[model samples]
Target chain A: MKLTILGCYAATPRTFTNPTSQILDIKNRLFLIDCGEGTQVQLRKNKIRFSKINHIFISHLHGDHFFGLVGLVSTFTLLNRTTDLHIYGPKGIKEIIKLQLRLSNSRTNYGLFFHELESPESEIIFEDEKVLVKTIPLKHRVYTNGFLFQEKIGDRKLNLDAVQNYEIESCYYQKIKNGKDITLEDGRIIENDKLTFDPVPAKNYAFCSDTVYNEAMLPIIENVDILYHESTFLQSEGNLAKKTLHSTAKEAATIALKANAKQLILGHYSTRYESIELFKEEAETIFPEVLLADDGKSFEF
Target chain B: MKLTILGCYAATPRTFTNPTSQILDIKNRLFLIDCGEGTQVQLRKNKIRFSKINHIFISHLHGDHFFGLVGLVSTFTLLNRTTDLHIYGPKGIKEIIKLQLRLSNSRTNYGLFFHELESPESEIIFEDEKVLVKTIPLKHRVYTNGFLFQEKIGDRKLNLDAVQNYEIESCYYQKIKNGKDITLEDGRIIENDKLTFDPVPAKNYAFCSDTVYNEAMLPIIENVDILYHESTFLQSEGNLAKKTLHSTAKEAATIALKANAKQLILGHYSTRYESIELFKEEAETIFPEVLLADDGKSFEF
Candidate 1:
């Protein structure tokens, strides 16, 4: 799995900094999360193909989180995109987007679909044979949701030497990889585990942002391979963070530590800070694996 | 008067090229015209004070012409702007902007007003003591209208030597500047022309874009000081320009020549061209003073 941070700042976008937006590539499928203003330009800077983005997930209705959505959608029509595009966001997303398209008299050549979420509980929003996506309700001033992306386990690896020793035909290799026992011509059955090796483990990633310190989502993101949490303020501004319903760096680290996530990624920094390294220093006090997110940065696992 | 080309290309924004957006500074009042995507960043890059822009005029409902407007409005709120903002655009502009603001639950502290235009004839939309703005109807695929900005004539300049020789009092200087004759204590009348010289001639600028090669607006923009017209293609692709309802470089120059404009600026270029100098060359073939509009370039008249 690979993740690219297109923009990871807070509030308004500036010349040197952008708001929240990221790209996640899992199981060779690209998923866009939280498109802020100037996201299309950011995508071009990162060299990510606009055509590869089939699914876009918005965290909330805040301008910082999803303001660039309409522009991106309009650009798709200008580029003559034909692939189906799916959007998952809060309930009002469809109305806002549809209004702009109608007023501009723009019609997409591709199939456009919206999956509006209003549930306050953790529920699977997307699932396929290779991947699963669930929403983790977040505590914020607005109706917000953070998504959890999990890659499904793949088929078991084939033990070529063992299969050849058993004189099994090549056509039966598919069944063996599916974890089925093979039978010889004499009707004697062989165990499935003895013929194949174990498959590689799957990975899970959780994205959380623009929320206050809340332990309610800990259980939902427990043992996640990677966790991206918002750290809009530092510990020195803890009071301000709470007053604004935003989490501080230390608070995000505490949540990551309590959830037992393998690594923690801190983002959505306020532009008032002189350096982002302060957030990393504050987060490292509680979490051992802490990483800072900047625009155009990428991580692979 | 000064004009800044924040972005002048056509269609979707790219990494190096931007869509249609510009800043017109006339009579010391900043007016934003046609805000495209990334215009906020462009404003920052151009070192323009955002607070100075209180009026925005959009030429059409195309995405490239006004996609960045909502973001700019939201950013103004984030910056705690208290000044009123006025927008002049097509009839559906208010509905689109109000819908996004409603869905996001954003209430501006400043007054926001929209002046929707559906007129098919020339009319004055805005008039102040210092300036006048009128709509110049154009032929395009949509209900597009170009704007004509004219600086009102100022008071006549005082000839200090001539006024002092005529023994005019300081209190009467204001009257003299207003083009009034002065009567001396000796009962001798002094003509206004002897006391003061004429004021600088009023300058007029016309912005025409996203329109075909039509001369319907020539009378409205006659003898304009500067004219900025859309040149989406060169003369080689004039047929394609006709089909798309866009103007070629030669056509833009033709309009400027027929209107007796002092200078012509060609902008809104299609990205298919390798260089922009070709546009200036083609336009100069028809008009004497042809300027090219490039991103970040500025013009003073």
Candidate 2:
């Protein structure tokens, strides 16, 4: 899986910094998360194709989180896109998007689907043969959710030499890859483990932002390979973070530690800070494995 | 009067080029016109203070023309602005803006007013003692209007030597500046023209965009000091321009010529063109006094 940070700053987009938005490439699908204002320009600058974004997930209805949505949808129509697009967000997203399109007299040529999510419980929102996405309920001033993307386990790998030595027919190779023992022509039995090897472990990534540190998300995102959490404030601004329903660097690190995530990625830094290095430094004190998210930065795991 | 081009492209915003938006400074008021996406960043880049802008004029409901408005309004609230903001646009603008704010649960601290315009005739939309703003209706894909900003006639300049020669009292100087004949203490009457010169000629600026070559706008913007018109295509693409309800550079210059404008500024160029120099060259063919609008470029008239 590959992750690209299109924008990581908070509250407002600046000349050099952008608001919250990211792209996750997993299971041959590109998922957009929280498209803030100016996201299309950021997408263009990052050289990401507009057609590749099939699914968009908005964490909340805040302008800093989803104001760029309508613009992106309008641009898609302008480009004459025909592929069906799916949007998963909190309730009221459809009204906001439809109203703008209606006023502009722009009827989208593509099939636009909105899956309004209001459930506060952890439930699978999207699933396919290769991947599964679930929502992690979050604590915020408004209803918000964090998405957890998990790659499904693949079929076992066949050991060609072992299968040939066991006199297994080529047609039985499929059965062997499916972890089933094949009967020999002479009525001899062979164990399934002897014909195949275990497949590579599936990787998991969790995205959380615009929410305060909530232990309720631990069970939903437990033992994830990578966790991206918002660190909108420093440790010194803990009061401000609590008041605003945002998290501090230490608080995000504590959540990552409690969830036992392999690595923690910090983003959504408030613009009030002069530098983002302080966030990493503060997070490292609690969680040793931490990465700072920056605009245009990409990570492969 | 001074005009600053915050963004002047058409259709969409790019890395270096922006969509339609500009700032017109007249009579100590900064009026924002056609706020496209990413306009707030452009405003910041141009070093324009948000507090100075009290009025915003949206030409139409197109995404490229007014998508940045809500973000700007949200940012103003975040900055703790207390001044009232007035927005003038189409009839449906209030619904679009109010819905987004309601969904986000962001109640603005300042007073927010919307003036919806659906008229097809020229009428004054805004006026004070020093300035007056009228709408010049334009033909486009949707309901649209071009704004005409005119500085009201100012107080006549006092000719100090002429006033002293007439032995006019200092208290009567105010009356003379108001274009009234003054009676001296010795009962001698002095003509108003002799005591004071006529007020400076009222300067007028007309902003016309997203329109085709419609001669109906000539009377509304006639004899303006400066005229900014949309030139979305070149003369070679005149057919496309007409189909899109846009104008070519040649057509814009023709309007400037017919209206007898002092200067013509060409903007809203389509991104398909390789260079903007072609627009200036083509427009100058019909109108000798022509200026090209570029991002961050300012004009004084």
Indicate which candidate wins on DockQ. 2
DockQ of 2: 0.83
lDDT of each candidate versus the true structure: 0.93, 0.94
Off by over 4 Å in 1: none
Please provide, for model 2 over A145-188, each residue's C-alpha lDDT reduced to its tens digit, 9 standing for 90 to 100. Answer: 99999999988999999988987778888888888987788988
Q: Candidates' TM-scores?
A: 0.98, 0.97
Q: What global local distance difference test value does model 2 have?
A: 0.94
lDDT of 2 by residue, B4-68 (tens): 99999998888889999999999889999999999999999999999999999999999999999
> What is candidate 1's lDDT per residue for B90-193, written digit by digit as tens?
99999888877887777888999999999999889889989999999988888999999999999999999998887778999989889999889999999999
lDDT of 2 at A87: 98
Query: Each candidate's iRMS in angstroms?
Result: 1.2, 0.6
